[model samples]
Target chain A: MLEVRGIQTFYGNIQALKSVSLSIREGEIVTLIGANGAGKSTTLMSICGVTPPRHGEILFRGQPIHRLGAEKIVTLGICQVPEGRHIFPQMSVLENLEMGAYLRQDKAAIKADVDEVFERFPILGKRRQQAGGTLSGGEQQMLAISRALLARPTLLLLDEPSLGLAPLIIKQIFEIIRKINAESNTTVFLVEQNANQALKIAHRGYVMENGAITLEDRADNLLSNEEVKKAYLGI
Target chain B: MDSEYFFELLCGGLVKGSIYALIALGYTMVYGIIQLINFAHGEIYMIGAFVAFIVSGVLTLTGYGGPTVLLLAAVIAIIYAAAYGYTLEKIAYRPLRAAPRLSPLISAIGASIFLTNYVQLAQTPDFLPFPELITDFDFMEPFSRYVSSVDLVILVVTTLTMIALTVLIKYTRVGKAMRATQQDAVMARLVGINVDRVISATFIIGSALAAIAGVLIASRTGQINSAIGFMAGIKAFTAAVLGGIGNIPGAVLGGLVLGIAETLGAGYISSAYEDVFAFGLLVLILVLRPAGLLGKAVKQKV
Candidate 1:
């Protein structure tokens, strides 16, 4: 489980996240839904130590990880697939995947995981030799997820995986997220603006406004709430 | 314009270009990873030559002359240069990683000035004689008319180093991490690459290449001074810019072209105007293509 307690994050003088807190238990798919620039990505970034919160603490499995470096956080079994599918543009798809397993020493297991990733996403296997920048948007998103998965992370933090993808591809991606949670029992902390699709897959959800968490409830309950329906779901 | 004379001049140009390429790679690779010009890179080369000079002096005094002393001196110079490079980054640029872009650039210039003065005060400011580490080879007798054993050695050593570097950047784990960091530093951290260590490795590798160039040039030219790195560094930096600062192959091509152009201009035109040709070509390249010969014109995201 991960616990974020009263964290404030900033960029220079401007505060991006203020007094924000959230929690996720193991093996659960939790989505944070908000409109644009509501500090959803900042929450994940703070958790990953990319931009450590200026105040407050983050505990992962009862260990204080808020002060750790970004790579240290990853070494502790947390991997992030950042927004916009930031794959290495010049590297081949295979090379990108190799980078995902950069810290693991278990070569045999890494290779097995790679094979499994390829088997699950055959299109990626077909385009293994192609440059990552040349891949279509959906394929790049898949590569980004596959790259993070190669880390064999216990906690997978996904930020806007459905952004800029076709509706059909988005459906496939959501299905994959659900299947990953079911099969591997991996804890997923998903941040997205697509509240409808995200809540549909999430077991629980939090609604964020500005830089604070406004509401938290079971996914179905939040989906049916009047304010959540009008503001995020556009019902 | 006799063919023999042309060939001799061409050989000389290649010898000079190989040295430039070795040093230029340092500039290009460092720039590729972090967008700093690393103004103090030349000082690392100077430090390398000085270390070799001191080590070879002590070795010669102890009656350890010839290739063994040469090899020992070169190896120590390389190791010392790498250490200096690592320390320099830790002190000069690492702390300013999040500072304004101009802060690191200014810090690099400051480090350069400080190192240059430190060397001048520690060692004599005058030129010192460097030993002829590379002796004459009997196999080169047939071609000695156009190139000496030293020139051939420089060419061969530089070629081998280039091949090794190419392999390091292409297939090695550290190289892949370096490439990943270069593309996306934040994502690289997400995948568990210690980015600070990667930057340190870049400095180490780049400094090693510069040290190689320093020792070879000191041996060939027969003399070195505290200020040798200044001109060589400028020329190599120019070469990097010419090829495209962040492009690997561009650095090699740029160094060779700059070396050949300068040499030919000196040979054909007035020897006093050698630099005019070099800077002239740079200005021409800048006017025609500001992004450089091999550099793409994409807008860099802040």
Candidate 2:
């Protein structure tokens, strides 16, 4: 479980996140839907301590993690598949996956986890020796997710997993995301512009606008809400 | 010219190229990881030579000489150089990690100047003779007349070190972390890798390689001074750029090519224009292939 309270994040003079707060209980898929520049990615980054909130506290499993370094935050079982699928371009797929388990010393478990990732994304297994950058956009996204999964994270944060992908690939990716949550009971905090696909799979959802969370409701309720349908669902 | 004479020149070129390869690795590796040119790297090589010079002198005075003492002195010099590299990164480069790119570059140049002067002040400005270590053996007596034991030593040491480095980067966990950091620092940190430590390790490994090169070059040339690093550093930097600055194998190839070109140019054309040949190759490479021979054209994803 995670709790974020009154976090304000800034990018120099511009305030990117204003008192943004949200929570995710264990074993739930929570998606944050927003338009461009809605601070969805910023919220995930702040929780990961990449861009720490200047005025808020983030607690993971009842422990304060807002002040820790990004690397330390990862060791505490949180991983992010960053926007744009920032896979190590020159490294092979297997090496990228190895990097996911960087902090773990248990070699046997790491190997088994890698096997699981290969099972989930068979194309990644096929291209295990190929450089990450050489993969297709959808394949790269799969690699990014597979890499994060190797870390054995308790909470996985996915930022725009469907960005720059075909609709069919997006559908497959969302299906995988759902499969991951359902089978492993993994807590997922997804940030997305594709509200329709995201809310359909999410147990709960939040609508962000102008760096603030403007609405929070159950996924089905938000899907039927007239204002939500007008502003985000495009009904 | 006789075939033996040409062979001699070829051997000499290889020896020189091996030295350049070692120094170029330092330049290329550091630049690859941090995107900092690390102008101070050449000075680290200079210090390594000086350390070996002092250690050899002490060893001789204490009645210790020969191959064992020589090897011991080289080891000490390498350890000292690695330490200097660690401290230099911590002091000169770490603080400027988040600053604008130009800041660390300027700081690196400043560090280079400070190190060069520090040596000049601490020791002497005069060119001191490097102790005779491995010159006694005739390593290539059966095969070639011109190649000596020192040349053999340089080639062997360089080859072994490069192989070790390749293995370290390819098969090791830490090396994977380094490659990850090089590709994306933020993502690397997100995976629980200490980016600072990886950067520091790069500096340490690069500096150690340069240290061995300095000792070998000093032995081959028979003398060294504080200003030696200036020309060597520039040439090695040129070699790194020539081979594609961030590419490791490219650095070695560039170094060997530069060394052969310079040596052959001097032997065939004129000695006075030897440095010109090296610089000319650099310009030619930049004009023809700006990314260096092995450097790939990186596409900027917007």
Candidate 3:
């Protein structure tokens, strides 16, 4: 339940996103696949108001979110798992997860949600007391997801959860994403460079180039496309 | 000097050293999380002593009983001073959280100046007398020692405060949040830290410590003025720098070392250049170790 239309974003004088538009419906996983500097991360940032679109409209569940601050956006049930895992390095895994529900009241629901995250990523339960910085790349990726999950977001935005992760860990993360969506029906908007893995799970996806949405198709259809293979799959 | 006189001076230095440790605690704690120097913290100390002095005067006028009553009055004054410190952070520091570090530093200095002038107007530019809470006891006199009851109280109170603060930071939820926010503000925000609240709490705690030091110092020296904080703040800041600006245990060690060095230098050499020796030691330590005796030198990533 997120909408984006004709948004332009900038990093000072350099334009990052130019006339980019895409949408994610309720309870679906949507991916934006791109090469480096293709405005994929910029698109997500614009949606979450980290860098508000200079000229565009973004709607989260029919409410205008483009104007809200970063903290306020999360209050509306839109959370982003930023690129680089960005875990509070000195904090324990449990503390990092607690931060995800910083805005939530009702202690019971928060506790239940934390338990659900630990259940999904059982390894985290074992090392909940360990500092986040001590976690391996793959473990840190799980921590990031569990952290985002703690927020209980209606729309969870993940930016490259597989970066710096091993192949086995990447597969595990994708599987967890599937389970999370299947079980919780949380709307997912993922930006990724791993085109094949992303297309496998994304219901519908957009191929972005130079800040524009150049291609849009069903996940399987785009996975088999010749041009998509040449540019992204390298097949 | 004889061994007894030497021991006497050691105790004297230790008493003043505790005050420096208390004040430097405020500086280091603020620097630890927000990376702010909190230049205004010294003024918070001044304000706290002033509150204690004013309250003591009122109490004496109303016939509140001796030293015990004065101690209770000082404690109440400390609470009031902490409220001032909390308000200072909320009103002055928190708004600049997203602003550049320089902006907050400038604001802290401005706050320092503002508080100094405000107190100067409320009290007086001249030295105001601190209540003589325990002058009659003279604890060290039985041993024919030079130390007074005031010196004893300062050492005891300062030690207790430091131990309490160390415990609070190590074993508390707020402590976890503070360290979390310190490591990564953005990540802390994502996890729901209310970074602003943690920062405010930190400032409040720091200011409270500084204020206690102020009250103790005023009582020990017999008088204080608006400008008293400036000299004490500089010495405490030097201690903070010597101990490593952001390291907690380092602050106490630095303060103690600087206090001894200053006390010994003034006793043996010119008293006018007492400050020079304190700061010179700070510069020398910073140049040699950069991290002080107890601090770990973090190898910077290239």
Candidate 4:
């Protein structure tokens, strides 16, 4: 479980996140949905220690992780697939996946994980030797997810997985996310601008406005909530 | 135009190119990772030559002369240069990681100046004659007219070093981590890579290469001074820019091209314009292709 309490994050003098708070329980898919620049990605970034919150604390399984660096946070089994996918453009798909398992030293297990990832995403396997930049948007997204999955993270942070992808590929990606959570019992904190799809798969959902969380409820409730429907869902 | 004279000049150019390539690598690799020019890198090379000079001199005076002393001197110089490089980064550039780009570049220049003056104060500012470490080989007697044993050794050593570097970058774990870090620092962190360590490793490796070049060049030229790194650093930086600042192969090509052009120009045209040829080519490259030979113009994502 991850707990974020009244965290304020900033870029220079401008506050990007203002006393925002959220929590996710273990083995559940919790999503934070908002429009562009509503501080959704900032929340994940704060948790990941890329841009540590200037105020408040973040606890992972009761351990304070707010002061830790991004590398330390990853070593503690929290891995992030950041917004824009941040795949190493010149590295091959397989190399990107290898980087995902960078911290793991058990060569056999790492190889097994790589093989399993390839089996799950055959397209990635087919294009394993191709540079990550050469992959299409959907394939790159899959490769990004596969890369993060190779980390064998207990807590996976996904930011806008469906961004710039086709509707069919988006559905496939959502299915993969659901399956991953169910099978591995991995806790997921997904940040998405696609509120409808995010709410459909999430166990609980939080609606964010500006730099703070505005509403939190069961996925179905948030899905049908009048304000959520009007503002995020566009129903 | 005599063909024998042309061959001799070509061999001489290659020898110079090998040294430039070795030094240029440090510039390119460091730039690839941090986008800093690392002006102090030349100081590491100069320190390498100084260490080799002192070690070899002491060893010969202490009644231990010949190939083993030469080998020991090179090894010591490499180790010392690597240590200096590691310390230099920790002191100069690492503290300014979060600062503006210009900050670290300025720090690099400051470090370069500091090291140069430190060497001058520690040793002599004047050029000291370096002993001939690489002796002539009996087998090389036949081809000595075209290529001396020293030139052959330089070429062979440079070739081997380059091959080893290529292997390290292509297949090794740390090398992969370096490439990953170079491409995306944030993502490299997310994947549990300690990017600071990668940067230090880069500095160490680059410094090692420069040290090799330093020792070889000192032995070949028969002299070294505290200010030697200033000119060599500029030449290597020019080579790096010529090859495309961040590309490894580009640096090698740039060094060779610059060396050959400078040598050919000096041999054929007036020798006074040796540097003019180097800078002229650079200006031409900048005017025609601002990205350098192998550099791609990076498109900024808005």
User: TM-score for every candidate vs. truth?
Assistant: 0.97, 0.97, 0.86, 0.97
Model 1 ranges with Cα > 4 A deviation: B297-302
| Model 2 TM-score relative to the real fold | 0.97
TM-score of chain B of 4: 0.97
How accurate locally is residue B84 in candidate 1, as Cα lDDT from 0 to 100? 97
lDDT of 1 at A188: 97
Model 4 per-residue lDDT tens digits across residues B211-284:
99999999889999999999899999999999899899999999999999899899999799999999999999
Per-residue lDDT of A1-235 in model 4, one digit per residue for the tens? 8989999999988999998888899899999999999999889989999899999999999999999989899988899998888888888888999999999889899899999989999998998898888788888888899899889999999999999989999999999999999999999889998999999999999988889989999999998899999998888
Q: Is candidate 3 or candidate 4 better by DockQ?
A: 4
Full-model lDDT for every candidate: 0.92, 0.92, 0.84, 0.92
Model 4 quality (TM-score): 0.97
User: Lowest summed lDDT over 10 consecutive residues: which window, candidate 2 chain B?
Assistant: B135-144
- Cα lDDT tens digits, model 2, A1-235, are 8999989999877999998889999999999999999999999999999899889899999999999999999988899999999988888889989898888899999999988888878888999998888889999999899889888888999999999999999999999999989998889999999999999999999999999999999999999989989998899
Local accuracy of candidate 1 as per-residue lDDT tens digits, A91-143: 88899999999998999998898899899999999999888888888999999
For model 1, the TM-score of its B chain against the native B chain is 0.97
Candidate 2: tens digits of C-alpha lDDT, residues B190-298: 8998888999999999999999999999988899999998899999999999999989999999999999889988998999999999999999999999999899744
In model 2, which residue pairs have backbone atoms overlapping below 3 Å? Answer: none
TM-score of 1: 0.97
Candidate 1 Cα deviation (angstroms), residue B74: 0.4
Q: Residue A82's C-alpha lDDT in candidate 2?
A: 96
